[model samples]
Target chain A: MNSTFANVVARRDLLRELTLADLRSQSQVSRLGWLWWVVDPLVMMLIYWVVVAGIFGRGERYAPYPVFILCAMLPWKHFTSSLNAASGVLRASESLIKSIAFPTMALPITQVLARFWHHLFGLLVLFATSWIAGLPLGLALVQLPLLLVFQLVLVLGLSLLVACFGALIRDLKGFLGHVMRVGFYLSPTLYGIDLVREQSANLGGWMADWLPRLFLLNPFAVLIGGYRDVFFFNRMVEPEMWALLTVQSFGALWLGYRVYLHFDRRVIKFL
Target chain B: MSDAPKIAREKNAPVIEARGLGIWFNLQSRRRVSIKSILLGSGLRSDQKVLWALRDVNFEVADGSVLGVIGPNGAGKSTLCLALSGILTPDEGDVAVRGKVSTLLSLGAGFNRDLSGRDNILVNGAYLGMRRDEIQSRMEEIVAFSELGDFIDQPVRFYSSGMRARLSFSIASSLEPEILILDEVLSVGDQAFQRKSRERMQQMMARSRAIVLVSHAMPFLRELCTHCLWLERGHVRGFGEAQEMLDAYEAELAPE
Candidate 1:
């Protein structure tokens, strides 16, 4: 990995300019402007709580199911929404990319950052809900600051590949969303991880063991499970599992960044 | 802080260099993208027919000089400028530039239409490789030079096309670029802005850096350029001192 790559990309300020510009334009569109970033997502969470909470024997599973789902869904929402925003970034910025010298992955990087700003608001709401529900808090939750770093690297690295592909093939936008949706259900979010192990001696058990451990490459799962361990149980994230997760997250990151850099120089000419 | 020592730049090396420079459109060999296919959403492939905007062209511009490029409608002038700016990669051959470049390919080629004039100024400042502090220091000068009135606060799309041109040109020329590229963009404004454009070019040229002026106006080329290259249908027919090339090119343009 090039040590200076990220810093150089950040210095270009194209991403910064575009982000500030996006924020400014967004603010002018409505009087309630920037606040909509938070209010919109919280409203979606509320709707899901009202609709889905009542349907499944969702209450039987655990404490304050609404907040639990929100905690799990918060980072997931960011991951998915970022994919949607990033996929079209290159195609839309034909002017900037074609005419200037800068990192192409800055497109996906901006998408991740803008959505991260939105996700941070959702996280605050999660903390508030946890407090209202009277859930226990401990040092386990502090892992968030560290874990989110890995999540960001993973997201930035992986989404860049998809953004490039999306530029070439327009349908990649819908394809990525559909794929993430499937990953949502397949993941242990909202549901327990044991479902797969329950069918041990078969493919289900095999998947359960590998999915959470190996696929910790997915920072969201580690984040969600870490949330459950910290708030729901007041326990520390298993040290061994954390190690596995860290390696996978950064490993995916290293490879993805290479792919992004490999194609960056060609983007201007192609566009 | 380090006091920089002055060093002489090499003499033999050209300030601008292009060798056998050729750029061609992909001409994706497919019968798609025609209006019939586009309306029906059926033709997803590209057409295959090579269109050479520039071919086997060769030129060298020395340090502290002015080079004018003149050609007819399809003479690859803008393509050459784009290559110089590193915006387009040549399919064959190479281009190397010694110093920073600020290209005025068109009035609004790089500006965001939806942004306000002030916002576009900041955007252009950063696009021209100015640091934040650098742009902030000069922000007022840019605004005043634009003479945009209260319209500067409104989205650029709300302004007349001429207003957008003024903002882009002012912000771009406000910075002293080592290599300046002017792409026939001066004809937009009224006579007053044209005079200002010429004045700005003269001031920039006075700094003793190389520049490439591409225009169809042979008289202006003759008047301003220290050297000139006359292009005819993607070929360079004359390249030498400005007056001589212009004389040769004009003779060719005469009825025959």
Candidate 2:
């Protein structure tokens, strides 16, 4: 038990170092450097805003659609970017994995942490935009950190699951690209849960009763809704929903870690 | 030199022990076997050949001794090193290791090419189990040992192969781990640096650290090693005192 605790501490130190290395290399390689972190989400927001608000003339329900979309978009980018980087991480770090005796799980965790750094910058942009758009700051904002932590837990779990299979499957990276593209529309990034409920009610049957619940089960649906409530709608996420999300996020993490360990030895051989 | 072997073997406690160790590799799937191949049943082809890279190997390393592994190319010396260092999991038997291990498997194996030498040192040091504060404290010593000077701050991609060898060796050595594993790492750099490294290794040995070295340089092995392990075609050909093993190895080479 003592050695195990020491092992955990050592792994944590290695994770910190690798994440810093990843972030440093990323910033140093590009000409614009750290500016890209802020710019990336803003650019993504502009494109989505133009399409949903400008071209389609949808988003009439959510005024100041930019802030509404930015809140969820930032977290969504964090999710997708982390998974994308993790999907090929084992194969990409072949030399390091082969040479060092450290835990392999650090590879995927580093991706999540590095991307989270960028996500933090996206949050800064969100706060500035909220201030400029004259959105009210209230006690609802107190729940922001809790929401972000839960989202991080969710992303870490998914990243580990992807990294484990992605190392062996080779096709997971491309497959995940498609899945995330579709998932983006399915989540409440561009619209609100109100839109989903109203659309579901139009169906007017058991489909109406089940479709919204099914949507909420996606985990991101709950998280994005929470962000919207805190940042745009000025309300707390429903207690039952927050409780469910807490369970779901940690459950995914537990399952992901189990799956990763199951394939951990095989992964190095495959690589 | 006469009493060196006896002095090296004076310590009786084994720091490393392996029994019936084996590592198997799928010859047909040297690269990653794709999921598409498995789905299509091509991965199930009976033509796949399994290669036991190391089979039924047993060895032990006592504290304060150097065990030199010598073999021809593809004789599984490096495989044994990997297993010992805990990088590769054994397929059949198990290896037991005590105390901290630091491995220099290959030059620049974990160094990020885009990062500066100083940054790579911190990163590699962490991989070798050093904490950030520990690495920071030893920063000056590692840099000075590498002799990278102004080049330490430049991106490692700009470094010459010799410079990388110097930096990696310096960092690994600075860790001063309980067990040090090296795989042909001392072959690079200029002759002066090689001699300096050899002297540094002697200093480490004098301090009673265990070492696992793989090299083709017979004279260096004979001079530094107390025990020698000879691997031939994934099996142990010889294991005993360093002098006896080297003599037998040289005899075999002369006939060929």
Candidate 3:
């Protein structure tokens, strides 16, 4: 038990080094350096806003849709990029995996943490945009930290699950790209929860009552809703919803870790 | 020279023990099998060929002993080193290692081409389970041993193959792990550096509880190894005293 604890501490240190190296390599390779972190999402926000708001005039219900979309877009980018990296991480570190005996899970965990550094930069941009848009920067904003933590737990869990399968299935990386694209549309990024609620009411049947509820089942839907609530609307997601999302996030983490443990040793052989 | 407590070193107590160890690899799935092929039912149509890289091999290395593994190319010597180092899981049987193991499996195995030689040392040291402060403290010694001098700060992508090998050897040897596993790494760098590395490896051998080395250098193996294991086609062809095994290996290589 004592040695296992020591091993965990050593693994944490290794994770820290790998993550720092990943972050450093990422910033060093590009001419723009870390600016790309903020700029990438900002550009993505513009493209998404132009398509969903400017062309279709769909997001007017949540006026100043750039800020609205950026809130969710920033977190969504974190999710997508982390998962994408996790899918190919084992293959990318093939030589290292073959040579060293460190915990294999560290590869995906390092990717997720390194991407979180970029997400923090995106959050700064989100705060700046929200402040300029005259969104409330009040007591409600304190909830942002908790929301970020929950999203991180949620992302880490999903990344582990994806990484385990990704090690075995060479096509998973490409397949994940398509899945994330479809997922972007499914989540309420361009639109608001209110729009979904109103549209459901317009259906005027059991469909109206159950449609929005069904959408909330997606952890991202609940998470993005929480982000919009804190940053843009200056409100709180319902406590019950917060509780449910928290449980779901941890559930994903537990399930991911379980699956990773089941396949981690076998995964190394494949790599 | 050993850093481990004196009480821990019981003379001739085995630090590494392998019992009927076997490692097998699927020939067809050695390269990653894509989900597309599996879903198309093509994967099911093929009969998998399992190649036993090591089969029913057993050995034990006691404290303060060096074990040299010698075999021709494709003979699974490197596979045994990997299994003992705890990198590759055994497909059959078991290997029990009682101490921390450090391996020089391949030159520059974990290096990031964009990072400098010095940065790679820190990264590689961490991968070997060294703490940040520990690596920092040993940074100068490791760099000096590599003898890369001014090139230490240059990105590894520009490094020559010999320079990368020297850098990796320096990092792996400097850690002073309880059990050291070396695979064809002693032939690195220029002749002068090779001699220097050999002397450094000798010092490590003195300090480490056990050392497992894979090499084609017969004279060097004869000088260093207390025991030798000769593998042929993933089977133990011979195992005994260094002189006897080396004589047998050389006699087999010479014409009748």
Candidate 4:
């Protein structure tokens, strides 16, 4: 573990360069250029807005549903895209893995950072759209950075785990998309957490109470909830939520690191 | 090109030592298993076969010497190079190296083609364990060695394959690692550039305490190496002085 940290610290610049290179390689071929990075999420947001607000008449259910969805959707997009990219990144970097012998963790970390770059751009668009929608921008925005740090840790850990397992399980490359799809519905991406609580109250059972707890157990729900609290509500994350989010992120990271360490040497053979 | 007192040749002080080093790959059985077969409790037994890429390899290379590995395709030359450099762990036994190791196993690897040749240098150099400032300081030398000139700033995708090869080789050579493992990357660039690379390698070898080269070009190995190992089907066919091993390997491959 000490050696692993030393290796990462030693190649910090290389990691940065690899992350930048990922972004450049992705955006280089497109005619829209770097705009595509932000445009992708923007388009997805518009599609959701059209379906949920325009067709389903969900616009009236929540005042400015676009803002509500954007806050959660953008972060969810970051998480899903990062995981998706990270999972297959090892197989995608078949040539690089065969050629160079750097830390394997660097590959997943690079994926996380690359998606984070695009997510950061998408986030700027989100903030602008939120401001236009009359969502108050205030001291709560300061909590945005804290939330980002926690989310980054969560994403990095999951990415490592997925990347490692995805290397071993050939079916996982395709299956992960399905997993993320299920995760999207399970998470509070398009809907409100309060909606779940309200529905659960109407059901009136132990099972109903457990359903909301199940949602909270998901790190994505906790993070999306935290992001909404800061971006829309302009409030500090509750102390208990903060503790839970911290524990979840770091716990995932520790587990991911252990898994990576177990599989790092074996990854080459799998690749 | 930094002048430091070279370690004098000392008997029994090996820079790299491999004791019964072996590496194997588990080839996944191609027989598809369906849910029906699993439910019937058939095809549940493991069908994985182990392909030993390298087996029972043992060698000790001292400072101020080059160990040239010569082998035909699938002879585990690259596997040995990778294990020696700490890239691939051996499935059995162990390999120990006493100094910083750098490998240039394949060309244009880990390079983002969209990035300029100069940027690739920084990334590759960092991969080889040099710090950013260290890579930056050697940028001019790497560029000069690669001779890409104006193409250095252009995206590497446009460069010729030889040009890409030159860039990768130059970066690894510039690092001047104590234990350098180069796997068949020396045959790069044009004839004139190849000559320059050879000269550059000679200079790098002068500085590096130990070097391992895996190449199909036997004469190149004969000229550069003090000792050689010839591999065939993951087994060492010959290991001795360069001239003796080369002659024996050549004899073995001769007609009839």
RMSD of each: 5.0, 4.5, 3.4, 3.9
Rank candidates by TM-score, best first: 3, 2, 4, 1
* Model 3, span B154-232: residue lDDT tens: 9899999999999998998887788888888567899999999889877887888888989998888888899999999
DockQ, computed on Cα atoms, for candidate 1: 0.28
| Count of steric clashes across candidates, in order | 7, 0, 0, 0
TM-score winner, 1 or 2: 2
For the candidates in turn, chain A alone yields TM-scores of: 0.86, 0.96, 0.95, 0.95
Q: Candidate 1: where are CA atoms >4 Å away?
A: A1-12, A199-219, B1-9, B29-53, B109-115, B231-238
Docking class of 2: acceptable
Each candidate's TM vs. the true structure? Answer: 0.85, 0.92, 0.92, 0.91
For A157-191, candidate 1 gives per-residue lDDT tens digits of 67776776666554667667778988998776766
Model 2 segments beyond 4 Å from truth? A1-6, B1-12, B38-48
Q: Candidate 4 on B1-256: residue-level lDDT in tens? A: 1111123435666887777889997765233333445457763667568789999988878778899998789999988877776777778877778777777777778888888888788788766667778888999998998888899999988988988888888887787678788888466789998898888877877888998988878778888899998898888887889899998888888898
Q: Candidate 3: how close is chain B to the reference, as a TM-score?
A: 0.88
Error of 2 at A151 (Å): 1.1
Q: What's the ranking of the predictions by DockQ, best on top?
A: 3, 2, 4, 1
| Candidate 3 global Cα RMSD | 3.4
Clashing pairs in 1: B28-B47, B28-B48, B29-B47, B29-B48, B30-B46, B30-B47, B30-B48
CAPRI-style grade of the A/B interface in model 4: acceptable
Overall local distance difference test of candidate 2: 0.84
lDDT of candidate 2 over A1-271, digit per residue (tens): 0112235455698889899999999899998999999999889888988998899998677978889999889989999999999999988888887777777788788899999999999988888888888999688999999998998999998998999788877688887888999999999878888888999999999878899998989999999988888989888779988998999899998888888877876677778
